[model samples]
Target chain A: MAILITPETKIIVQGITGDFGGRHAKLSLDYGTQVVAGVTPGKGGQFFEYGAHKVPIYNSVADAAKATGATVSVIFVPPPFAADAILECVDAGLDLAVAITEGIPIKDMIRVKRAMTGAKTRLVGPNCPGIVTPGTGKDSFGGCRIGIAPGYIHKKGHVGVVSRSGTLTYEAVFQLTSKNIGQTTCVGIGGDPVNGTNHLDVIKLFNADPETHGIILIGEIGGNAEVEAARWIKANCKKPVAGFIAGATAPAGRRMGHAGAIVGGAEDTAAAKIAVFKECGIEVAATPSDMADALLRAAKAKGVTLT
Target chain B: MNIHEYQAKALFEKFGVAVPKGTTATNPEAFVTALAALPEGPTMVKSQIHAGGRGKGTFTNGFKGGVKFCKTKADALAMAGNMLGQTLVTAQTGPVGRKVQTIYFTVASDIKKEYYLAILLDRATSRPVIVASTEGGMDIETVAHDTPEKLFKVLIDPAYGIADFQIRDLITKLGLAGAEAKNAAKLIRNLYTMFWETDAAMVEVNPLITTPTGEVLALDAKVSFDSNALYRHPEIVALRDLNEEDPKEIEASKYSLSYIALDGNIACLVNGAGLAMSTMDIIQHFGGTPANFLDVGGGASKDQVIAAFKIILGDPNVKGILVNIFGGIMDCNVIATGIVEAVKEVGLKLPLVVRLEGNNVVAGKATLAASGLALVAGDTMADAAQKIVKLVA
Candidate 1:
């Protein structure tokens, strides 16, 4: 079983009438994701057909979650209403919510995050590509072409991949696939300052997963999240892990789309993270390809071979 | 995203927090008039820039002589004329810097109470945290490090906002008592209100001082606005000071690309910030250097991509170029087309390596397929980085 989402999970599409939301809903439906409901506030009682199944639309997240019993919510609402939409989902008791929208006000996110602290609900991103479980189906807020990277790259193996960069995750998977390495799950933990599920959290999940033999962690510059995850991996993770920290050449003080990817001072550099991971005895890849190779090496070191 | 001190203080004042009366000055005459309007006493003239560390530099002391006690309009005018349009190079921003566009002239308060306070966006916690200390005026970073317990922090609940009890506790911890404590609490609440209303990423008041009359005054203000929220706040649009920012950064802003100037030799143009920073770090680790950190963003058009390339090449210190693109919604083929056009336009003789992956990788490779340009296309990020490092070396 995967960590958060699966094929049986009923999903609700927030801002379903909007261009971005509507487009991703169609793609998710095409990918065979169990999209049970859509919500666009004023456009309630409308219907969108996916295959033989017809999904009903609702006015609000609470209404949709009540009627459809949607466990997961993918939000495509614009930046302004992002926090409100997520809060509504959390209030509705939806197990997981992923906000595909970018440019959310930091204040609004802080409020959403504070509210989410004790709640059972889990939030993914205000700015991210969302998550995909390969052939079993995918639920992404951002546009990632289906079958772009062969589905065979993700076999139900014992290797799990967690990344801050969505594209890099795909790259790592592509490399692994070429090497005939498949994954139990590949999680794209969006690179937002106030994102839901960090590397440490994902590492904990991978550690607990019996199917996962090794894990590949992809990180970026800015926060000490990667360093913290490395410390956690050293202490808790029983499996061999290979890692790569992005943002090696990024200058300090520049934010690169991802709110979490900012280099305020010298200590937050990518090299510093690499040094930390190395000290923890986790093999560190200087580049993306090296990351995949390092993961393979770690698997070999642990005597877990892939045919 | 960073607004001037005057703009930050204006927002603070609107929320009922007392700030030193100040006006933004575009010219020497306006600067003089604004300074002359302040009450007769030793006035503090602060250079208004988005960056910190202004206090330790040339503009910190106001004029060439000691603290200029402006008794007459002429004295203020002389001070304004000298400071106006003059670049204040500080230890923080380095040489060749921000022009003194606004001079904050205010009455020096009688320091009965001084406290350092800031509401900053904490990345780790992904929340706005209120950091306050009783030992004020000096650097808050110093306070945070030395007497860590002395610095009381309160994580604000976004749904309910800064509670009344939290405000009272913060004031008490800041060594405030009685009516003065209440006033201080009110100021804290007002500051939090201002922080929300202005869509500020950071709002800091160093030395939130109390006068001999027990009046709370924000002696110094520092604010960083959310750039994405600038569309909503049109007033902040006027506060954009191009002179204070790097020319390349300013140019990249025009194309909506995120860029930060760094002191390195290799200019990097990556699709995303994480990759860009990683490339920079790798360059430094391999004994090479990076001149700038540029992220073309996700939805970059060919023109925008070309513009980003041009900006990177504009850096005089740039010895080589590294273009790393992991195409998501943005196609590598689209980026390659822009790179081809950019190389021709800029006539870049500097060694370059292009790492393009995802979304039509075959087509992306085909576009630049066999172009006799000195461009080396890498199949992966490692190859591209290693190639660039070797070429630069």
Candidate 2:
């Protein structure tokens, strides 16, 4: 009942020949994901060899998808080519494309996003830690581990975690795992101002998933995405949700690492987002360390068992 | 990256977007020559800095304004002299202010009316939007708050570009007519071209003026390009003024580290941007102020750790350091070893708290224990932030 992917989801890795792509592709394989094929444009007919897993490589996404029957792709292409890689996934009609690459130009992403309108391929991130639907195996091994997120911290269960920050997502997941709480899925929509997915998009998916009993929504300063998501959750989502927004102490106009993490105006500040979350009946995590406990409180108030 | 007003004006001209003819001088001696490039009539003397609210800014030397209107070239030159080297404190620029290293002189246009125009991505629609208003030459935020109806927006479909109907709607909203309307339409088209071609994050013309002669001009230009797209725009990169940035931040960029200097005293070095920001928040939560936000990125090397330490230590306000790492793809042991080496190399006296989690954390903790450095260890981010705050307290 994971939202986007599962242990049985067949996946392809774009930019599989590069150092970063190859390394993560191997890690994804080690996590027991069904890494069916690889796409490197010019590296066709080759195979990425890691331990016993030898994933075949094709020159194009279409070729890879056609031969291997892979439905999803995780892109690790460099920024300059990342946009084209995303478009190729749309062209090949992949169910989803998880872009792990960062630093893609905003213009490129704006075009990529525009082109993806009404398309079948749902793009995840251009500057994000990807998605994970935790496996039932030990340490959440054998799950659909897509991007650069560490595969070991996850546990298979009902709580859905969605965030824009990589380590913050891990922080929440780790907190949940430590308390013996498992998650149905975890999605990082990314920190880029022009990303494929937003907080609202992932929240809707989580709310729709019957298996996801509770949700953790992590956001930061900048953009009205978090506010939009919070308002939506209040009106429609009946599931328990905990929220955490970073950059509370951040100064105005200073970009805090993430391209989209800057405080643009009064509406998008951490304070404003936190207020909206609280107003929406969300149990707000006072600190990053309290994310798991906050969710527990929300679940208890709703009389739902997350574990 | 934000370019100076003069640079933005030059870029505007390149894209067929009209602006007041301007010249810049870095020294007072060249102010006269720079002023000569403009007409004999009224001129605008502006301090070239990255921040806004320059028109109302006061200089440290007791000079009245960063921007001034003068009737003669000699008067413009005098105003330029007052601004060229003095620090101008504005609402946007913190109390410390920024040194005015360059002076911009432009021929003042006789405004028939002032309008506001900007091209930026609309996050809601995921498209380029033109925010236009009849109210201009003032804080747009204020206008948005007080007179919301005066402001209008036209979302440009990336697929079809700006439509003629949208332009007409915008022109009507702005109360433009005849040649002014035609000129404004052209300017909007050209501005969109520049925004798309240059990969600009935002193109803001605070007062898009229609002169008495019916010529539409961008009276003030504030353009920022996407740093991610800077590789394709070497021309824009060349316009980068290093003087406007913190030296420590510039140094951090050289090592691919993301660092921003803050006003607090507790310096934080962490892995991942989100975690780094959270570390700062956690520090603040514990009643300790964070001096800086430094993300060493994933897979930080030994050299990067040393560089980060140097940058954090360079800030005189820093009383203690907190190193938080949640190694995902990153190996915790590698980071721990790097931290140990960084401390040994930098010769730290400030109290330091290190928290390592995730991959190879056991080995990482063991490495730190064996190093025997005078560093406190925390089991989690909360523990680490509290430890640093308490130690510094």
Model 1 residue runs over 4 Å out of place are A8-10, A15-70, A136-156, A255-281, A304-307, B59-76, B123-125, B345-348, B370-372
Q: Candidate 1's C-alpha lDDT?
A: 0.74
Clashing pairs in 2: none
What TM-score would each prediction reach against the true structure? 0.88, 0.98
Candidate 1 chain A: minimum summed lDDT over ten consecutive residues — where? A139-148
Q: How many Å off is the CA of B292 in candidate 2? A: 0.7
Tens digits of per-residue lDDT for model 1, B7-73: 7777788789987665555766566567556766655656677666676656433444212346554
Residue B3 CA displacement from its true place in model 2, Å: 0.8
lDDT of 2 by residue, B63-152 (tens): 888999999888887778788889999998899999999999999889888888888877777788888889888777777778878888
- Fraction of native A-B contacts kept, per candidate: 0.52, 0.60
State the lDDT of candidate 1 residue by residue for A1-307, as single tens digits: 6567665678898887787677667766666667889998888899976568688999988999889888889888888888899999888998988887878876677778887888999887767767666443222222222211223234444578888776677777777766766676677777677787888988898888877788899988777888889998888776889998887655455552211232222345677888989988798886666777898788788887643
The TM-score that candidate 1 achieves is 0.88
